[model samples]
Each structure stands twice: as C-alpha cells, then as structure tokens.
Target: MARLLSELISFLEALPEPRIVMDADYRIVAANAAYMREFGAAGGLVGRRCYEVSHHFSVPCDQAGESCPLKQSLESGTPQRVLHLHHTPRGEEHVAVDTTPIRNEAGEITYFVETMSVVRHSSSRPAAQGLVGRAPAFIRMLEKVMRVAHSGAAVLLLGETGTGKELVAHAIHEASSREKGPFVPVDCAGMTETLFESELFGYEKGAFTGAAHRKLGLVEAAAGGTLFLDEIGELPLSQQVKLLRLLETGTYRRVGGLDCLSADFRLVCATHQDLRAMVAEGRFRRDLYFRINSFPIHTPALHERKEDIPLLASSLLERVDRRPGRRLSPAALNWLQGRRFDGNIRELRNLIERASLLADGDTVDLVHVQEMAEDLPLDLSASAGDAAGEFRVSGVQPLAELELAYLRWARRQQPDDTGELARALGVSPRTLYRKLRAAGA
Candidate 1:
C-alpha cells in the first residue's frame, strides 16, 4: 500500500495546474511539479501538513479560519468547490479550488485531490474567504459588505460580542482597493485619554516624561491603508472630541507636539453596544457617531442564521482536527443542527473542540456529542441522534416478516410518504407498496 501510494507522486507532479494529494491526516502525501513551482521547495512536501506550506499556520485551513474545500469533499463523498485568496510569491491572489475525494477499496475516504486555479476578477473575490454561511441574512450581509468594500467609505460594523465583527472589518479591507496597505486595529475599550492620544497620534521625543524617542502611532502605521477603531462606543467624551477632530480635518497633532501631521487612512469602527443609544444618553459624541456610521454593516447573530450551522460546524471541526479522515457522522450532524449556539461561532468552536477530544476514531458519534453536552451548560438533548430500534419482536423472524416489520417502523418515522419510506429502506416505492400490501402491513 505504501509503494502504491508513492507511485502517485510522479503522476501528480505531471499535472499542469498546481495539485496536491492530502492523506486523511491532511499531510501532503504528493505534490505535482506545478505545485512545487507554485508553493513548495520541491522536496520534503510529503511529510509536511498542507496548512503549513499554504497558510503558514499550525492548524488545518478550516481550523485556522479558512473554509477548506479538502475537508468539504471528504464529508460529502463528492467534489466540492470554493474560492480562496492564497498568499502567493507575488502577493495575495484569488484562487478557485476544486476538491475530489479518493476512496479506498472498502469505500472509505482515504485521500483528497485539490486543484487550484487563479481567479482574475476582483469583484468575485469572496468577501471573507473562510467565513461560511448560506442563510439568507448572511448572504445579504456578505453582499452588502462586498458592495461597500470597494468604495472608500467609513464602515461601521455592529454585532453581538461573538458575532465575528473583526472578521467582517478585515473582509471589507481585503475586498477594498487599499488591500495592500496595513490594516491597523485599535481597541478603544478602556483606553485612557493619555493612552488614546499616544496610540492614535504618536508622541514626539521629550513630549512626555517617559518618551525617550519619537514613536509612530497606529494611525501613522495605517497610512494609505485602514485604521479600525473597535468598540468606538467605549471612547471617552474627551477622546471622542479628539478623534472627531482628526476625522473631520484629516489631520492630527502628536501628543504634546508642535506640528500638525496628516493622517491619510480609511476609518472603520465596530462595537456590540448601541452607539445611537450612547449618543442619546450623552455618552458617545453625536458627531463622531455620524462620522464613523457612514455605512453601517450588521453581522447577524448565530441564532438568526440557524440554517448555516451545519456548514459552520463542519468547517469548525475540520479547523479543529486535521486527522485526514476525521468526520462528523450523520447522526452527530442531526444533533448539532438543533442546537441554539448562544456564543455564536466562537461557542460552536468550543463545543466542537471539546467534543472532538471526547470522540474516538474517524467518526464523531451521538454518544461522544451527548457526553460533551452533558458536561457543559449548553441546552441540548439526545432526541435528534437517538435511534429507536426497528425490531419490536423478541426473537428472529422470517425474512419476509423482518422486511415487513422494518418497513412498518420506517413508515412511523417518515409518516405517510411512500417515497420517503422507500428511500429510508433503499427500495423503490412500488416495491415498498407491493411488499406492505403482500404482508398486510
């Protein structure tokens, strides 16, 4: 088997496009010559994990927060496709990826084939490369972000604490024209007035008691780029006036400095708090709120997009565990679909992380998931994955009687749909009806 798998290395190396074969453990088992030219050193790829060479991350692409087509294909037992922004030698480039699963003789997925094509269009770059969502609200939000990103507008992100606002902020920056510029993020929460001034505007030498030399502030660091002020509602009234001055004038003076310097940077702000209410309560300055709120983008909370949970969970698990063949069983998925993820994406990551550790083998089952759930305070139940046996009889019955009994059981679960019952038993609806009628069931 080892020699057989090694033989694939030569065949893969001949492909025109960059292609790699990852084993169930996500180790790069083989890479073609194009792949070597594209992203490798031409040797020692066989032992390295795919994420290390491609993403420079310690974890899998899904866990490192990129939607992974490799993992997606493994689970579906079919080809999967995704658009990604990969860090190439030249810079970030848009790549369309197609993944196909390779199954062993016993029909178990053992490896994946990943082929990547560079996408040329700018508008089609997925706003957030790894952020997974299919819900209507999520799609709407993504569309809005994509549209707003290209323009040099001040974007205000609003969402619950765990709703992934920073990811949205970065997406807007990535999709915008200034993607090459540095994206400097500032957390405004609990920053003292002195700290705010020093951080946003650099202090000249001898300007302050501890200032031994001139320091470059975040605003200057983000020149010709983006300056993200997260939790802007936390800015004190005194600091708000100073930020307003900078935004309005497009200039700022260093802390205790003599000259005014230009701050050529795009502004983006985000917070879970209601800035409008803060303004109404006289906590947040009205003018600053208006300056940053030119284009408001709201990230929907997890519950609002329940339909996306399945993909989200799959993506998160793939991110957490990269053991090539690890999978969330159909039963486990049925259980996860019914969860109310209060912590949103972050909380889901925790659940999967813990449950993955509890689960053994490639398939994470109902028992493993339920065990994790019982230990946590999360509200969940076993009703989804639990299966009540089809056999109501105490002893073995004839094959005919067994078929009729199982068909009857399938009917109770599917209820009144001949096609659904037939699907459950892997039989044609006509055959299902004929058997039931023959058995007087």
Candidate 2:
C-alpha cells in the first residue's frame, strides 16, 4: 500500500527542503532528493514507516496530541500546515510543514504530500536556543563564560562533574585568540605521579623501560593552543608541584632530558572540589592554587534553576533522538522537574536515554519517565538513611574526596557489576577501574 505512490515520488524533487509522500499508514512511499540528502535516508525510502523514519515513534502523530497535517488534509480534503520543531543534521530547527492530500475519483485521500521549510522567528530565544536555557543563573554563567573566553587568563572552572565544565572550557577555547591552535584535553584523575609527568612533559626515547620511541607530552601537543586539564582537584601534590613549576617558569623539560622546552598553551583547569579547603589542609599547594585560580567560573547545577527544566529536557531529548519530531510530552517535563537529580544534567541525560529505550511512542510521557526513575543511582531515600552518614559530612570535603567515597560505597554495592557501577557513576567501566587504580582502590 505504501509503494502505491512510488510513481509520483520523483515529482517532489523540485519542492525542496525534504519533501515526502506517505500512504494511509504513515509509511514513506517515496522521498525527494532533498529529503534523502538532509535525512541520510538516500538509499531506502519506499515502504518504510514514516513515523519511524521521521519521529522515531512507534505510533502516529495524532496519538501524541500533535496536529498531524497529513491526517488533517486526508480527512478534510484540503491543504494543512503546522509548525513543529524538527531535528536536522544542522541542529534543532523550527520548521513549517505544508501537507496536501492526494485524493482518488471518489474524493478519498490516497496519499499525503509534505513540504518542509525551515522557519526563522523574530522572538527566538538566543542564549537558550542551543545552550538550552533562559534561566537567570544559566544566562549569567554563559555571560561569564563568554567574558572569560576573550582573555588569556588561566580559567578555573568550578562545577560539579557533569555540570558541563568541559563544554564551557571548549567554548572558551573556541572564543579565544588561540582558537585555530590545538585544543587538547587530558583527564588528570587517573594518572600516577610518574605517569602524570611523562604524559604532560613527554618522554625521550629510552626515558623508561617501555620507552621505545620519543613522544610529545600533552603540553607540547597543545602548544600554541589550549590545554584543558580536567578534574584538576584530583591531581596529586607531587604532580601539582611539577605543574606549578611549568606555570611559573613557562617551561618544562622532557622526562630524562635536561634541556627545558617551552609550551605556549593557555591553561584551562576544572574541578568540582573546593581548593581552599584542600589548601588549608595542606593537601594542595597554596602558590599553585593561587596561580591557576586567576579567573574562576561556576557552572550551575541542574537543581539550581529548575525553571529551565523544560528547555533543557527538550534540547537533551532532541540530541538523544535526532529524528525530526521526537519529543517529551508535557507530563514528561513535569515528571523531570518533580524528581531530584542529585547527579544533575548527567543523570538527566542518562534518564532520558533510558526512557527513550522504554518509550514505544513518539512522546515520552510521565509513565515512561517514572518507570525509568526506578533504576536511577544515588537514591535520595537511601541517602536519608544510614548511608547518608556513610557518605559523611565534615566541615567541608574536597569534591574529589566526596566522589572517591561514593565510588567506594558503590563498588561495595556492585562488586561484580562493572557495567552497573559505571552507569551509576556516569562513566565507562574502563574509567571506573582507572579511577580505582589511581585512587589506589
């Protein structure tokens, strides 16, 4: 039944911007060249279910309470147009679709002809458009990030992990004068002191037992660019001293070499840890901390601006499922706002991804969200019990310390479940084991 319109599909080529013909069951009978190119559906189009191809949905559009222009035109025997947000290869876009019905001699609708065109709105949300929020806190943070990006000052991004510190770091690098240069990022959380030095400062051939060839360190690799050191708070004091010398002297020598080499990279370091507490406890060097803390910026946690939940969830959902019309129903947005995401955006992303798997429909509703919430890690209920005391509360703990403590507890809980532990921690199992080894677990 779908391929019945295959003969007329080729005629839509001139309409442009992804035109398609669909049958009564929402199956794509034929698609134009624009549709194929834009949607990456060049080879196969005939007989494929339209909802699956366009929305990643298991059902029809009207079922989601969305105005299905196709259905409307079919029933009324007239033109139908509806504006909807579409996920394109470029990004999330507002598209105006014009749907026309093809009818038989008896005036019964036989097929739907859809023409899509991208729309530009005057009252569009700018800061919230791609970044996905108009909340004051998020807006202020974006302003600070933009300001910090233009300067050459060392940036100390203070945010809980998964609050998007690295994203801001990349934004800063992109906005800087050194954007054309390399933007190298290194995870400092899981390296030994020796490994840290070698990785950051490179190594001469025969520098160590396994040193078969000369290699450039991350610093050298990032010369004339930005070197982003992630999880800076976890860097050991021994390695911190070396990093301090490089920052102070602007030079570092290769492992097993005397000649000092210069690296002209801008420094951008991030940590969720409170460095002042570490400095007071003599765990972090005051001099190094002062040097790197030149321009401090904080990324707000998800719970900080709950008002932006709708924007963020919609943006994240579109990102997870890029099919043009996939989305979360209003109930799903409310569901997200009502919950406690101690893990912040990272947790929300995981939940959304999981819910997408569980949801058989185009829209993820309250039921789908609640069903997926059962598996979320770090139960607040458990946190209220003795496990709360187990997680601890001192005057103030470094972020790294808190994370390590949680990892230990989670490890105990899932000793044989590496995947579960990784999912719980928002990291891969390889990263989980690497962190354990680095922390001497």
Candidate 3:
C-alpha cells in the first residue's frame, strides 16, 4: 500500500498543473512541485489539513457552504469537479478543482488526488477586463463555461437582455483550443436576409450592386476560432433556413460565386428569448435549435447576484470613469446596492458613467448618483397636488415594507414623474427607484 501511494505521488509530480494527494480525512499527504510553488505554506504543506491550507477554513469546504469535491467523489466513487475561491499567496482567486477517489486493492477508498487550476479569464476580485464576479450564480455559470471551453461543441448562451452574454462568449473563445484564432461576432438582431448571407458567407466582387471588392464573411474570418451570434432570436425566420443549411452542410457560397466554401469555425449563439418556446410557436426551426443548443450556459442577471453589485460597480467605475484617482463614495456604493437595474450590468454601467460625468471632485457621492437617476425621463404631466392625501396601511408589516408600500402609493398619485414624486415625498429620486423596485412596481 505504501509503494502504491509513492508511485501515485510520483506520477502526479510530472504533471504541469498543481496536484495533491490527501487522505480520506482531508489531510495533505503529498503535494507536487507545482502545488508547493502555487499554494505553499509557511511550514511545509504535508500534515496540514487541505481545507486549512487552501481555504484557511477550520472545517471542510462543504461545512463552509462550498461544494466539497472530495466529499462528492467519495460518494460517487468517480471524479468530481467544482469551482472554488481559494486564498492564494497573492490574494483570493477563482480556482477550478478536480478530485478523484483513490481506492486500494481491497476496493476501499484510501486517498484522493486533487488538481487545481486558476481561472485566468476571470477574477474573484474586481478586474479591469474579462469576467468579474464572486457570487454563487456567477461561479455556477463559469463552471459550465470552463467545462465546454476545450470542446468543439456549439454553445448557446441564454439570459436577460443585459446579462453580458457576449462577454461570456468571448471568454469561451479565449479559453478554448482556438484561442489564437479570431473571434468574430455577428449581431443577429435586425439582420436582413441579404446581409446575413453576405456577412456570414462572404461575397465575391460584383455579387450585388456597388460591389467594389470581395469581402470576407464572418464565418471565414473566424476560421479555426469561434463565431458568436448575438441575439439570434431576433433573426428573421426567412434567414434561419439558409443558416441551418450552411450549418448542416458545413459549407456556404458567396452571393455570386458557385463553388461551395467550407466553414471552419465553432458556433456560439446567445439570446434573451426562449428558442424552445419559439419552436413550439413555429417561430423558430427545431432542427437549428438543436444544432446550436449543444452546450447551453445561462448568464445570470445582475439582480440574481446582487451580492456582486459593489464589486461590479467598482470595476465598472474604473472602466467608465476616465478621471484618474476617481472613486465611488461608500454612500454611493450603498445607494447603488439598494437600487434596481432592470437592464442589468448595462444599466449599472450607464449609471456609473453618467455619475462620473456629473462628479467634479475625486469621489462621486450618493448625491451624484441620485442626480443621475433623477435625470430619467418621466411623464411630468401629473401635478404634485394630485398626491395631497393621507397615506394609510393596515395589518402589521416591517418598517422597510411599510416605507416601500407608502412609496408605491405615493407613486400612483403622482404617476407622471418620479422626480416630482420624490420632491413631494421628501425623498430623493434614487430612494424612490429603490423602493419602487423593492415593491415590485
């Protein structure tokens, strides 16, 4: 048994990724050079608990509300994979963990071999580019992205309008085997049949009127890489058949050319619309839906992961605010966290951009953000005198709930303009929007 364990450790040492062998009790027995260099302890790692070394946790990861791959592998008797935020030497980082159970000759599970890899395309902390999230929903979605990144499977991203599907698609492309190849994005929204053909399949000179030169289509440009089709639900049904034929045959022809050009690119489609329902309603082709739905990943909406609001807002402020040393005040962050964003990340980014523009000093305060929210278009037709009545509520309720209810009632009286309603209610427009969203109005 000792010799077998030694051999297993030696074999893991040759691998590039960080690998560790631990007992069933989660004590680190052996670690490869990669593991030592990446997650080295002040004292040697051996004899230390894996959870303590990696997560600084007194208990197992599962006890800490994280999925424990070791516990999972023990139950399934197979490999288990999970994404975890690990405490690294630099800082907290998003790490993908794969654990396999090692059984002895008696068929009893003896040890576990765990491999760790850091996610480069994303960050647990705020990042300047790529994905920035630490919420459970974000991790769940990222786990799916990592699983399908190395494969040739067609990817379908489904989410709300501003859920950052295109960014997810780009992350997939960057992580995939075709990282060196071009990543071409084609917006399917409002794309005409003629444009779809010429744009996706390229066009020969004189293929149509005003054809001055031959053009390379998006599919051909993305050779050996990924082609992202954004908002594919908006694509006209008339053009869907042509796209289906091209995908099925793996070939296409120029507008005026006769020779069929072979397409050599991975397909990734995204939509805020439900393609299954579209198929049921005869609005989308079932065959094409199946083709692109090989590996579907859900991009979580901002509201679903509200815990990441501060991180997202900080990162977005960095991206949008050109003024160096500018930052959001704590009050501003608090206000942002309490507000609602129906347009998700995009809406949050716009708010930050507008606030940045309005802010003159280094720090953008709550008033700056509130002013931006107040600038929202309102009906402004109803007068404030319409809301001059006593507000009443029955039954026991939380103070916050009561406040939100009162805001809703006040909103109904002055339904025309939220800015005017805020003045009448003696609250800021930012407060009005937050309470309104909480009230589900």
Per lDDT, the best of the predicted structures is 3
lDDT of predicted model 2: 0.75
Off by over 4 Å in 1: 1-129, 322-325, 374-441
Q: List the lowest-lDDT window of 10 residues for candidate 2.
A: 120-129
Task: Tell me the TM-score of each prediction against the true structure.
Answer: 0.57, 0.57, 0.87
Q: Cα lDDT of all candidates, in order?
A: 0.76, 0.75, 0.87
> Considering lDDT, which of the candidate structures 2 and 3 is the better prediction for this target?
3
Ranking by TM-score: 3, 2, 1
Model 2: residue 148 alpha-carbon error in angstroms? 1.6
Q: For model 1, where is the 10-residue window of minimal lDDT?
A: 376-385
lDDT of 3 at 356: 95
- lDDT by residue (tens digit), candidate 3, 278-301: 999999999999999999999998
The predicted structure with the larger lDDT, 1 or 3, is 3
Candidate 1 lDDT: 0.76
Q: Residue-wise lDDT of candidate 1 within 1-441, one digit each (tens)?
A: 565466666677667998988887888888787977876553467888877766668988889767787888877889987665565665555565778887766788878889876543231222223566656577667756776878999999998888878878887888789999998999999999999999989899999899999998899999989899998888899999999999999999888788889989888899999989999999998888899999999899887777677767777777786464577888777666655576788887788788888877988787777677632222222122225633444343346545555554555566667888788778899998897775455
